[model samples]
Target: MRLRRSARIRGPGGSFLRRPPLRVNVASPIELRPSPDGRFLACGDQVGWLRERGYGVDSDGCRALELYEALYLVERGDAAALGADGAPLDVSGLISLGSKRNPRFLTKYIVYRDLRNRGYVVREGYGLGNDLRVYRRGEYGSRDARYLVVALEEGRRMSASTLGRIYLRALNLGKELVLAVVESHGDVIYYSVSQFNLRRRLDDAA
Candidate 1:
């Protein structure tokens, strides 16, 4: 039998690994609590493991994780989300709770997991009516975001005007707009969107 001399480990494809993981093969899952308003789940700043991976928003010296973030960690066996009663919520329970907080939470989570699995740092998005922001792979926490993501269920339709508006907003923000469609089978399909003026193109060519 062999034992690792050092405890350092990179968290689930994390880049800024400077300390030991929050928990390493520990029997008990690390306990996490929700904010007073039940919007975010937190467990103090000890979650540097999550911070290095760009998972939570820090507040008052604590890093509070979004619903998608906490749910992902719970599924990965690294942490457990606790309810007000101080009982652990399973993945399904967390999903139900998250749904109340954000009706599109499940959809967002599907896309978030897919993006993270494919090696991108996903952050919460706002102001652009976007669902998420994706940093270029390996650029999170250091560089500006590369893409603004909108997640939707498969077979859903969006008017060209709405999509164009989103694309234009992303362009104005100096970012590309990406659409993530999740299928019933939990598969994710990605589409990059941009504003191209067909009318202007025809007029200029003419």
Candidate 2:
């Protein structure tokens, strides 16, 4: 995807600073607290703020932002996310940390960013055998997610059994299953998959 040109924001020194391409209108910058488990970011008091932006709240009634969510928020300049060490991270810094934690970070980011750009509400799929639970635009909070997206590198392959499991889960949940293939050049292609069965009838003439 082609990014929009950076907008100039006046810095403390009266010089212009380059802002990120994506812009989210918010009253204040969202705060992200590192989770105790060291896997996700917790929005304690900022839960409502993030939720208002389409971030989903977990069963615990708090918004537990995933790595991709936090990265996207930080990249879009809508949130100031501190790491486990309580240090602010720029986009490049966050990318570095995310890459270190997840080997497929870049591929997932490409797909996630692309989906968000297309105006879908994306949330991390917890234990659903997918990368994201995507809500159709403007249907968030009013309806269940319409798609379960699994992000994979362009050339990466999945076993038939694994694919079957994922398809079955989506089918049971009554959601469409999408495979987002991220190429090395930062392009994403999406394919929807559904299950079907067929039987052949014996021909009497044969």
Candidate 3:
């Protein structure tokens, strides 16, 4: 934008300054739709802030929101999921459909919502139904993903091999591995995981 040399008028020898801009915060609901493949929710300009805030991935000229992201936005009163029928889906309604779409939907949603509420930006993870990519509080969109989060339910048993693979993936991606456990009582607990070189430790001890 080009700055005006003078935004004034010679009225009564001197013109009064224009009224200051209204720097008020106005909340507008965002609109979104399911992608053609039904795997993601497509949004246009309404998702600009969401994209900047690391909500979804880019698809053509729009951003695609996953079920968990959509649910979070709906619950936050910032977005609405418009169905094919052109009607918006309510939070409870979306949860019902989401559960059917993915068996671990609630667990994933719980972790995702909690992370967002805790001031982190979360994006899709490397593994489906396994993890999420997270950014530090103020580093989203400007820095690499800081955490590779693996979501699990309390009391659920995961094979060590599977965890090893996830750890390797995070290591290769140069991110810290985090395990997010959702308790039966609907609380999320986070634990940081990292590789420990036992051989090196043993040699040092010897």
Candidate 4:
């Protein structure tokens, strides 16, 4: 007679413990963006910002998912290849997507909405006729309407060193670089430019 194993299992020493086989969970695909250099980024899972447990999955899944997202972004003209940081980039007279098909485009849109809700005057503006710009009600302060540029686009080819330099420049400009890398429709991974901030601080020290 064969004994069927239940959800719970008994050990050799007659100890009752729950030793179950790991299982894979079915997850829906999420959207993310890649750097202009064709490098994947983590934008969090389609579910949320938290990781699921006992899912028998890892960052690899997130990376694969990111690749899938890259495919989609490339299909849309919203993404394009651009030169690296400070490489004599001549964007003048060049047309930009202006956040047409960005996956997180709505997030920034909401930020503008929230600012408007705060009784701040906002207007539609683009940087020297480049991308869109955000302006306050009045007064030309540092926080006035500034040009928003997508330094990197999904599915663009670039060098690692060049990417690093771009990230460093963003940190120097007091901007937190956010990136999302999804793996294989499994999970999405996200990170920020904290390291850039730290490194810049260190450079200042030196």
What are the Cα lDDT values of the candidates? 0.70, 0.68, 0.69, 0.32
Q: Which prediction has more favorable lDDT, 3 or 4?
A: 3
For model 2, what is the C-alpha lDDT against the true structure? 0.68
What candidate 3 gets wrong by more than 4 Å, as runs, is 1-26, 39-44, 197-206
lDDT string for model 1 (128-163, tens) is 543788898778878999888898977887766666
Question: Mind giving the per-residue lDDT tens digits that candidate 4 earns over 1-206?
Answer: 11121222221233222332222232433333334543333344532321221111135444322222222222222222232342321112011232334443322333332333333333332222112233334532446443222222234344545446655665455544443322222122333445755567556655
Q: What is the overall TM-score of model 4 with all chains considered together?
A: 0.23
Model 2: runs farther than 4 Å from truth?
1-19, 22-24, 39-46, 56-62, 126-130, 196-206
* The candidate that achieves the highest lDDT relative to the unseen native structure: 1
Estimate, for each residue in 21-104, the C-alpha lDDT of model 3 and write its tens digit. Answer: 231221776777877665456565555776777877788877788877877777666776887687788667677778787778
Clashes of each: 0, 0, 0, 20
Model 1 Cα RMSD, Å? 9.8
TM-score of 1: 0.78
Q: Whole-model lDDT for model 1 versus the true structure? A: 0.70
- Candidate 4 CA-lDDT value: 0.32
Clashing pairs in 1: none
Off by over 4 Å in 1: 1-28, 127-130, 197-206
Backbone clash tally (model 3) = 0
RMSD (Cα, Å) of model 3: 15.3
- Model 1 Cα displacement at 206 (Å)? 20
lDDT measured at residue 74 in model 4 versus the true structure, 0 to 100: 28
Native-to-model Cα distance after best TM-score fit, residue 24 in candidate 2, in Å: 4.2
